[model samples]
Target: MNLSFKKPSVDTCSKCDRINMKLKYAFVDQATNLKTLKEHQEAFKAAYEEKKANKQLAQSSEVVAVITFDLQQCLPTTYLQTNVAFYKRQLWTFNLTIHDLKTNKAFCYMWPECEGNRGANDIASCLYDFIINQLPNLHPNAKKLIMFSDSCFGQNKNSIVTTMLMLVTRLSPQLQFIEHKFLVPGHTHMEADTDHALIERIYTCQEIGTN
Candidate 1:
């Protein structure tokens, strides 16, 4: 058979779903909405393709670095299967992974609920600190830094993170250009996800202790 079955994705794009729903009904006008859907999906595909191309470029060139970053789902500290321990208060652990396509390295920043809440400030700070430490190590010719992440406004798309990126570019002499882009919402599975999976597997072996 020429045709293959593609199962519906678990992560459905909200914008696509809304447009699809409208297209399903005869009453709703489809002209402009259909065009919008076409453009949106095309943009999504283009972004993914551009990231892939940039990754290849980064691997070969010293001037460019492509980094994909994402926050792992909160893991509860003192995790226990026992019925008594399940109800007890457990500190939430937050982890943010910044994976460089050029070096194939994942830098993780972690903190428990006691020290800080996982917010824009904390995320921006972690990224800024990482860049500061690693800036000296970057190649003398390095100039461009490309970043990929999901469009979670609170974490990635907000002004705080944007300002941090701006500050980094201004402060670092070698690093001049920084481009932060969001992946298609539903298709944002990234290298950072692998880090989360590995951490989760290890975390299950023993409880992750408090901060």
Candidate 2:
């Protein structure tokens, strides 16, 4: 990965001389809070380097994909009887986000109206369906799979998920290797978070308009 910073260069041509740059603003202090600022910069740099490396590696015939899955808690519109007079029903949404390292494309699958309890079996079932049914259509040439998920015991990072991946490798002729990894317990911020945020934002907008 290229670690050298590339300063913005000026374009010469009149028709295509426009410069495109993106600036991100966040509150950071380097005076007394140098540690925090440095940590943030290191994290950002690490992510950038990894992405660059993935892009370079994706050009090969080996297909590279990073997948993240999680369940989102959502409040339902209807109500039901409970210990209290009435309570709004709650639902769980299983969101699977796949980021193709080669093409830098993101795909999201949301399964709504899910039951409250989510175990390894449920997670494995959803992943299996995607792998066997949907993934081939999306990336027919992909042979190796890499998956990332939170360290939650019941939802992911368990024997069930490992078994599922192994089964895929064994059953699918196109798949050669499968690897599943658990993100740090508190540091799992990936594409799935962005997917969840978008869903939440859309739901919030709908609620406001309805009101």
Candidate 3:
């Protein structure tokens, strides 16, 4: 007589499910926002430190080399009514490394031809060869290698970038003996002061002369 029927557990309705989904999404969004904020903070700190170091290096009288490469695309004057064919044109890469006289450290690689049509591996190899063979012979006391390149194909290529990084890491023991450091992708003005701006000026002159 005192026994009562057990009530069935209510299933979650569609509206409740939708509300739960929205709550889950809100949490995910919040987490993503936090992660982004942390990343931005880290990047800012790193950038600030790099700017300070570069400014000090620039003021120093040590040897600094700016290296850069440039590529030019020349299209033929064929006015075909159908489709236009763009030739490979020409790929020109330049490496200019400057030395800070007082410190005797070379710090700069300027590659203007890294953008459009050129391969990243080519640029990376050029930088590697220049540092390992060319610069050392030029300045025995040269210890630092600073490279400035556009956010172009060369910098974005994983194979090229990885290879360059691997080479650097492998050479860390030798580099450490001379206090060598590599810099890539900082402020534009820093790069502009290096071979990036100079290369553009030279390339423009070359183009004008060719035409």
Counted clashes in each candidate structure: 0, 0, 30
Off by over 4 Å in 3: 1-49, 55-117, 142-159, 168-173, 177-187, 192-211
For 1-211, candidate 1 gives per-residue lDDT tens digits of 7989977434678899889888887547789889989999998899889889989998899888788989998888767777887778878889999888877788899999899887899989989987778645755577888889999898889999999999999898788899998997867878888877788878887664433
How high is each candidate's TM-score? 0.82, 0.62, 0.41
CA lDDT for candidate 3: 0.46
| Span of ten consecutive residues with least summed lDDT in model 2 | 14-23
Q: For residues 72-162, write the lDDT of model 2, one tens digit per residue.
A: 5543442223555244345545555655555555666566655424678877887898789877876688877777666789878788888
C-alpha RMSD between model 2 and the true structure: 12.4
Indicate which candidate wins on TM-score: 1
lDDT of each: 0.84, 0.61, 0.46
lDDT, candidate 2, at 98 = 57
lDDT (Cα, 0-100) at 175 in candidate 1: 88
